[model samples]
Target: MKYFLYWGCSLEASGVNYLRSLKPVCEALGMEFEEIPDWNCCGASVSYAGANDLAIKVLNARNLALAEKKANYDIIAPCSSCYIQMIKVNHEIQENESLRERVNSILAEDGLAYNGSIRVRHIQDVLFNDIGTEQIKRHVTKPLNGLKVAGYVGCQSVRPYGEYDSVHNPVVQDKLLEALDAKPVPFPKKIQCCGSGIFLPEMDLCLGLVRDILDDAVSHGAEIISTVCPMCAMNLEMYQDRINEKYGTDFDIPIVYLTQLMAVAFGMDLKRDAALHHNVIPPENILKAAIGN
Candidate 1:
């Protein structure tokens, strides 16, 4: 199936590895994706934090309008924050006539408006629901036979949106790994917040939260952790060193995008995908071992 792909800001820069992985995996699955042109930022938290509801809605509406203009009703967003924002604003504009009129008023100036006909889908939903485990397994050239991976769905993908999966118990990522013939190591902290901004103001709290999650994964015998959200991956990948140093643990766990492993499991062109370049906890050797490259 073809959909308008929205790359949000992070996926292009901070999470470029995710971009690298997703393209090849989607191609492998015969899924066609075309990026929405002139897509603007979703302003994940900044717009909402300052009570700029109108500004934020307008910003999100612009992207939706762009997709609608392109005649694509389904928008596939890989970033959890971007998916949540688009879905949230789309729902609000559809349900509230007042909000819709207000947003339209602002959008009228630019000759763009959101009609709420667009459906925003996370890639996780596309992989699990649309593609299905059986279909994905058909493409697995090398099964992750002995690999143990913990699934982390994190906060943004579930709560406040709950469009694709459950907030309380999400197993989409784990199932995707299973499709690759890998062992899905379950953990209690799978759906917990990865402490996105908590690390900056309260280092202790953030460190404790991250350390606990990693500890649980390791204790469960997880060699790597797979997450769909870039923020979740970032928090786990970026701050793992501090978590280890502060907690006196020797954890060197690799946190990778679900698509990265998918590319490997599907036996796509890993070298061209360049999936191993971004994350601090590199997945090159781990993935090579899985596919016996």
Candidate 2:
């Protein structure tokens, strides 16, 4: 019912729409989120790739340390990268006793230590597991009746830890969307990678990969791509022009947060509840049709 919300760096900075939409959805779901104090980076790609693996563990451990102080050790991250990294750290420290001591040793020097008691969770997981599909359906006064939404689970959030659900084929978002009466477009690229940290060094490769994802959804008759990760949304939605220029293709698919769709189905205002500020191809027409406007 309650969780220590970890607003990852990318989410707070670039995924502002997800933040705005998620707040209202959480309130509607009867959940409370207390932000963990002084939460630092989860060592996303920069630290994990550049610095020591121990550094990544300690970086996440510091945040877990903050969460450990709370009565409930549950920490929920809306960002997929953050969710994976946080849980990855917890899993690593718990499995490797030496690594745990090394992290605790470094933490003790800074008057911080984590017991690995923190339960790192993705928002989608909490929604499906904590709040059942039937409950979610009850909140849906305005169902996405005719709209076709492709569920994009990205790569990170469900993997390595497998806490929320299976990494092979994730259907939580699909099931949740179906519960709202939206036609779930199950595409092949739903669980595929969106380039991850390869966006910088290999922009072309990343663009090509993202293009495939967009095309897959559009080809599958998806009017809107409902996503759970900020990075995936950014790559799929933010790089549209580049994707078009690179592939010489015209794709205008809109990427929305799963929570945004839920909020709309729950009778929240179209403009206010699901502003979709980050989407390059605005979801106006698609969402309007879903809302029967």
Candidate 3:
């Protein structure tokens, strides 16, 4: 199986290690991974706020063109924001020919067109649907038997109409966690927004929202939070200290990317893989306790 690896701005800037870890795992599972050549930013959140229609159609269409030219396979994005933007654009272009034409006119400058030839998918979708649970299970060298994990789907991965995965009650992350032998803790805020794009502009609101989510997860007995989005991981991990100071609560929950958990279950080196680079509490001690290391 061949896939076009689409790394959005955040992943390229800070989450490159995740792509590094995922590629090796995919290769081991008999999948050919290729990066989309000359991929640009997915316009981040500003594009949507400034020009919703043009932003979605143009930014996502450009990335799709690159994938079509290079790999011609489905594009797999590790970043939830990129997945959302690309999928949103593809849906809009296919559904509305007029909008598609308008966007294509912009792309014509670079000799690119959005023909809807490619499909955009999140990493979780690829892992759960394309890769399958049995294949994931085979890579487990040290199963996470007693580790309790909270699967954070975030808003982007599940929301927006006509998307690949269901918005409410998403199960892909949970399935992946279960397949790795880690217990998936159910919480009411599973699909809740982690104040994603608003983290910087609205610090108090973001921290409060995150605090509530973490409290809910902890209340449900989640020891570590697992997420597919780099922003979600950063928020959940990086904001714990501020939240603790504000609320006088001990929110020591560790945040980890789903890729990191998979690497650990497969007995891959955590330290060397930069798993410890997270700002939240480290998961090493908890994982070690689970395996009695």
Question: What local lDDT score does residue 180 receive in model 1, on the 0 to 100 scale?
Answer: 88
Candidates sorted on TM-score, descending: 2, 1, 3
Q: Who is ahead in lDDT, 2 or 3?
A: 2
Clashes of each: 0, 0, 0
What are the TM-scores, per candidate, against the unseen true structure? 0.95, 0.96, 0.93
> Tens-digit lDDT track for model 3 on 1-293?
98888877777556655665676666666788788888887866656567766665677788887777765699887888888888877777888889878888999899988777788888888888888999999988889996899998888887775255677677878999998899999998988888887787888888988998999999999988888888888788887888999999898888878887887787877765535544347788887776557
lDDT by residue (tens digit), candidate 2, 104-152: 9999987887877778788888889998898888899888996899999
C-alpha RMSD by candidate, in order = 1.6, 1.4, 1.8
Model 2 bad stretches (over 4 Å): none
lDDT, candidate 1, 84-166, per-residue tens: 88888999999999988889888999898877788888888888888899999899887888699998888877777676677
Angstrom error at residue 31, model 1 = 1.3
